[model samples]
Target: MTTYIPSLTIPSVVLQHSAASVLLPIALGTAVGFGTRPSKTQKTYLALKQPPLRPPPWVFGPVWTVLYGVMGYASHRIATIGLRSSASPAIVETAQNSLTLYTVQLGLNLAWMPLFFVAKRPSEASIDIVTLIGMNAYLAYLWSSIDEVAAWCQVPYLGWLGFATYLCVGAGYLNGWDLHDKEVKEE
Candidate 1:
């Protein structure tokens, strides 16, 4: 006889209720982006170190919406492409490498919004952005290996990473993410 133990996970039936893998990550990612977004005050809060020069509050949602959509689709393509192709073993390693980079970048993408927007800690977000920069570079490198178009699709994402990095650094300079008692908690 053996003792039985329960698992601490959702059943497969609940874990995947649809084919919209892209939706789950995308919407949540966008929401994280949304949650971190600043109003005039937060941007003003950011003005302590340098020129605010922040975009209008209205622009954030729409721009992030489009970017999130593209990122999700690109990620879907990256995750799904090989399943449809029965390639030889020689190319499998290459595919795996590209996939690895793509996945890492995706994780970094998911991380950034929460750190910047929700936590309101640009310093932590700055740290995350460095990872984003590295991950984006790897993803781009992997993209070049697969196809020019796939690589090209990631270009805007890279630009976004760069812009976001600049914003994070500037914001951190102004607000000091380590400000207040918030630093006691893990961001």
Candidate 2:
């Protein structure tokens, strides 16, 4: 089976720096999380019939913050070490492909908030999260060859995505796949 590799949207030079790479996802995630209107999102969240073991709303912020930072640092490592001049061409190619996957998955990660919260479309959100998980899993595998630590960084994100999938599917199932009907007050 042939695997499809995505082109990197962010320049490799930009990602080589630790601060830029680490902060990119964190900044974007914060922007999206706040931009979506937290108050309304919270209201909608409270109204939904969540499944067992769902974390409280406040927990998500801290958890995501840490995950973003870790994943960002991982990307930095991959770009810095794997793309170094002495590395083989094959390693360099893999690193570039890994970063491309990372960038795309990060975008998907950011999009999930709007789909689930703003649009109130749990079904679509579920699909997005599922896809994100699959892509990240493959990304981690690719990173393993170039940089082990970089690959390890994906562990936390992947673990959270697994739990998130359960929460998303559970909420969709419990709410009849319609968050709009929930009694959240209009802004």
Give per-model CA RMSD: 7.7, 2.6
Q: Show where candidate 1 strays beyond 4 Å.
A: 1-22, 33-52, 176-187
lDDT of 2 at 15: 83
Off by over 4 Å in 2: 1-7
Please, what's the RMSD in Å of model 2?
Answer: 2.6
lDDT of each: 0.57, 0.90
Model 1, 114-137: lDDT tens digits are 665555567777888888778777
Q: How close is candidate 1 to the true structure, as a TM-score?
A: 0.68
Alpha carbon lDDT of residue 55, candidate 2? 83
Per-residue lDDT of 177 in model 1: 54
lDDT of 2 by residue, 46-99 (tens): 889999998889999999999999999999999999899999999998988888
**lDDT at 131, model 2:** 100
Best by TM-score: 2
User: In candidate 2, which residue pairs get closer than 3 Å at backbone N, Cα or C atoms, i.e. clash?
Assistant: none
TM-score quality measure for candidate 2: 0.94
